[model samples]
Target: MSTPDTTQHKLIVLDMAGTTVADDGLVELAFTAAAERLGEDPATMIDYVRATMGESKISVFRHLFGGDEARAQLANLAFEDAYGELVADGRIAPIPGAAEAIAELKEQGRTVVLTTGFARVTQDAILDALGWRELVELTLCPSDASGRGRPFPDMVLAAFLRTGAVDDVRRIVVAGDTSYDMLSGVRSGAGIVAGVLTGAHDEPALKEHGATHVLASVAELPALIREFPA
Candidate 1:
């Protein structure tokens, strides 16, 4: 068996929603609500949405609408509206210790970035809710990275390009809460790919998709980072 690669890391790419923030199934609620408004089968659409967690919202819409771009755009707009209302109603919260972990990482001079599948406005709402508008060095959405999100490595690689803090892909750690997040990290060639159980996918699903480590939540991230071999 090959020995585990233990490269020293300098950057951490994180996922929002179920990873760094409390999900509370709000995304599902928003999707189901949109589906109901669109007169689609809520059960089927929700199952599809759950299966494609971490994918771009537009892409998910496209899939749900059977590749009808116009209809997908309408559905996506509805989703954004519903999610925005939910956020405005104070239904979202930060995951316990997430802000602390981010602050700790920043204090160590490590580059920490937040990546999300949500659109820009929705992501900003989350940041505003958590009062983390300035905590992370950068915040990214699928549109910020050629409209491609997780499971494609676009967002992770975009972090490398946008931040310029990453001298080498192998010196990066990618942590999130979904299989798509793990797959993106793996495909991006990051040295350490971790998954947190706070999101949509479980440890087994994450591992199957290429998670090098799995944690109970983002609260455990700092310790995991500190334990990486120098």
Candidate 2:
């Protein structure tokens, strides 16, 4: 009997905001604007927002509003609008070499999927701003994966099922810049959960959360993937 080839990672799932796109505090700024617009004080929630950087925005709002679905929906809308406007202003940029790394991954016959915690509208706006509408074969928002995002393996599993890239979940590679990203990857049973330092959390937080490897930036990811044992 022949054994399955399990050496190479075939599916790559990457986070959008902090991993590939350099938002530079736009999420916090948008949260503040949204809170102010909703007649709430940003101070009461900014810390939570910062702490849960890679979580679904609507999920955050749901918690902040104490499960008031209406308020959470409103807040999520306002936050998405504020974020879309900032993206329109060109406040976000691709992390240096992020695009190249993705391209290289694709060139190597690996499937790349971009996942974000933002709503579909905001995710689209950021992609449009970066001219990355087609950068990867798939781009997922929390909504795309049954409305679940990081800290829950929904998006990662969604990518696995939707792309049909690899037969084994252990062949998936998940990369991001936050601890939640690490948790999601871990929950999904991915082969590698790599945390990059170009965004929210630091090395210790990522490592503590479940990151198998810590990198300086997404730019180093291609080489890491290539050098990973088969």
Candidate 3:
């Protein structure tokens, strides 16, 4: 609700989907499209797909679609095809003020890191669309030194390591939009857990999951960073 005190906050971590990109119903559309493509029950798979907000495309698909090989194939095909359609249609854009936020964080001598369940290939397209291919300092995907993904904290720790920041696991802030993002932040013992409603989850859901701070969007980040009473 309040702008976090970030004037001296050396690091800022970001979530990709709602935090940065305009998904245009991509997540849900992927599952529905995949189900139709695979000739399966979309209802049975909805739970897994919705639950996969913080998982890699392959991991999520594998869990939802069932089986390893089929999951990988389906994920690759579904995501690639969906993305291709999205690109061809050309409505994707970075969330408002996202690039500006990244740029300002750098201007303030802060190291900006992006961690997402999205794959590197998918992430590349989103970043390129956002015009942020060179604006960040770490992590193209959830995998780090540890292959583990979100809700496990490996990626968060990886960001800290890459930035050469405090690894005490107590001075980092993980800001995101999904419950999985909150879980990842808390599981990692990030000093702060800031959630935004711009993504799939709302403020109430974020609080239910362990977010101590909730902002309207990443656009309010600078204000949050500059005014926290901490």
Candidate 4:
């Protein structure tokens, strides 16, 4: 939902991996499993996996499989198998202060949309665990959309549309941990683009890519929102 002001909306879109969840160990695990399927070293394959953080799972898998549809599909099966087991075993949880930040946004009457590169299978459970299912009004996962994911503004534009923030871009604040997230926010004409170091990039990298604000993590979001004018 939007603010009561009615003059413009107050929208916040959050990214998953580095922004909301700490997948450092799970990511490494998935890489190891997928690499085994490819007969490669998990350590050697990490760069590829981490580089695809802001992309759809299929996109990431496809890259790992050398863009071959058949191999990508096979590798994806293995990766998901490993990741699913990890989640089922209580090995994953929301990042520090993630749930609190989203709750604060909602309490302030802002529309908080979750945009991620995760497929529904992964995102649904994550949201469910974090008890954030009802707090969000929109969820845009790449598997459900068109165009490239991040660095293309596809999901950002889609979030704006479904959240009714398209007309009031000034009230839009897109936050993520990847350079792709920052660049996509800029391309989407968002009023604010904040980057978090807890994700895949650092403060300097985020600023170099045109972030309006760079914070340590999503934990700092409530303060930032409060300081921003209505």
Candidate 5:
């Protein structure tokens, strides 16, 4: 018998850091470094950062700075600088099997779009580090979306709008490792909201945030999609 075809889903929107790329504490490190420079309590700030994983850096900074735009802008710049330097220093790598997963999905003719909380520069850095400059068909960051990043449906919706391939949001599949990712998919009315554990939030948190399925990582995504009933 032939394998079932489950590429019925039109698009798969993915998160970059922590989901596709190995975070390796680089995000927390950048957050801590920025917090220390800005005179915030590193431990407390890091906890906040953990909770807000998958959200845009400017949004995170806005919350961190008590909604002060100027302060948030300053902090955002610092965080981006720190993260870029880390990426340039060869501190980032693709999560094991992530690249292969993307390749397989693309081979199946599924449009793979990467969405992330990081700005364009940080996003590009990770793409370059992983040598996945052309692996994904499209990439979206907070600024690319008209609205906000994860925890909001803007990035995912933006992907839909930009691609013009996914006619219905319900035919879209959203997968990531954070609660924000789950919430974004749910809010966007996606067909499947899957959570992977290679990153920030755990299973319980993902479920609580509206994830429909949970997997070990993006490496498992191609199999799951392939096994789904068409």
Candidate 6:
């Protein structure tokens, strides 16, 4: 008997904020609010936040507060609260065709998982705001994967292990709108590390971080996945 072929099946891991969801600088806005709430200057930390766009929120706060765990926790909580409020204000929307693209991938027999660098609360709030609570079978936040996030590969690997969509890491497809997303994909050994122009980083930055393909938006993802040879 021959082994079943799983090569044609892919486990697709997608980033939320900038790739599937249109961010519109909401992250920075929320960061500013969080910083102000804590009486810290946003100007001092905004650069770091921008530079590490796809990193875990708590991880970002940890660095911003110079590894002071208490300050980091407070800032992370404030950031999540501010972001949740902004989300409740109807500031977020799906990137044009993002939903259709995911549907297409699913139709193609691929498993799609949405991953986020936000905390579980913020992630849930965004999903609820978008009515995407049932969009995919599984959505992962940093906390869901041992508290690790993008640029680390933990969440990507978690998706792989949890979904069992594909047996090989190379059968995984990772897509996002930031350089850190590209790095996470690369680190996870995914076959396709597609970067979109709809978010935080540009083409050069995406490519520099290890994007296998650069797309105009997540809208182009289904086609790209279709074209990849099994």
Q: Summarize candidate 2's per-residue lDDT along 1-230 as a digit string, tens digits.
A: 66544336889999998899999899999999999999999998899998999999989999999999999999999999999988898899999999999999999889999999998888889889999988999999888999898899999999999999998898999999998999999999999999999999999999999999999999998888888875
Global lDDT of model 2: 0.93
Worst 10 residues of 1 by lDDT: 1-10
Q: How does each model score on lDDT?
A: 0.88, 0.93, 0.74, 0.78, 0.88, 0.92
Report how far residue 118 has shifted in candidate 4, in Å: 1.6
Q: Per-prediction TM-score, please? A: 0.95, 0.96, 0.86, 0.87, 0.95, 0.96
Best by lDDT: 2
* Stretches of candidate 4 exceeding 4 Å from the true structure: 1-9
Predicted structure 2: clash tally: 1
Q: 124-167 in candidate 1: lDDT tens per residue? A: 98889778898888999999999898788998999999888768
Name the weakest run of 10 consecutive residues (lDDT summed) in model 6: 1-10
Determine the backbone clash count of candidate 4: 0
Off by over 4 Å in 6: 1-9
Note each model's CA RMSD in angstroms.
3.0, 2.1, 3.5, 3.5, 2.0, 2.5
lDDT of 4 by residue, 121-198 (tens): 777766676676886788878765584687778888888787685476777889999888888899888878999988
- The predicted structure with the larger lDDT, 1 or 4, is 1
Give per-residue CA lDDT, model 5, range 1-230, as digits (tens).
Answer: 88654666869999988888996889998988887778878887788888988988899888877899998888888888898889889898889999999899889889999999998988888888778888887999988887478789998899899887668898788999999999999999988899999999999999999998999999999888877765
Ten residues in a row with the worst lDDT in model 3?
Answer: 139-148
How many clashes in each structure? 0, 1, 3, 0, 0, 0
Off by over 4 Å in 3: 1-8, 66-69
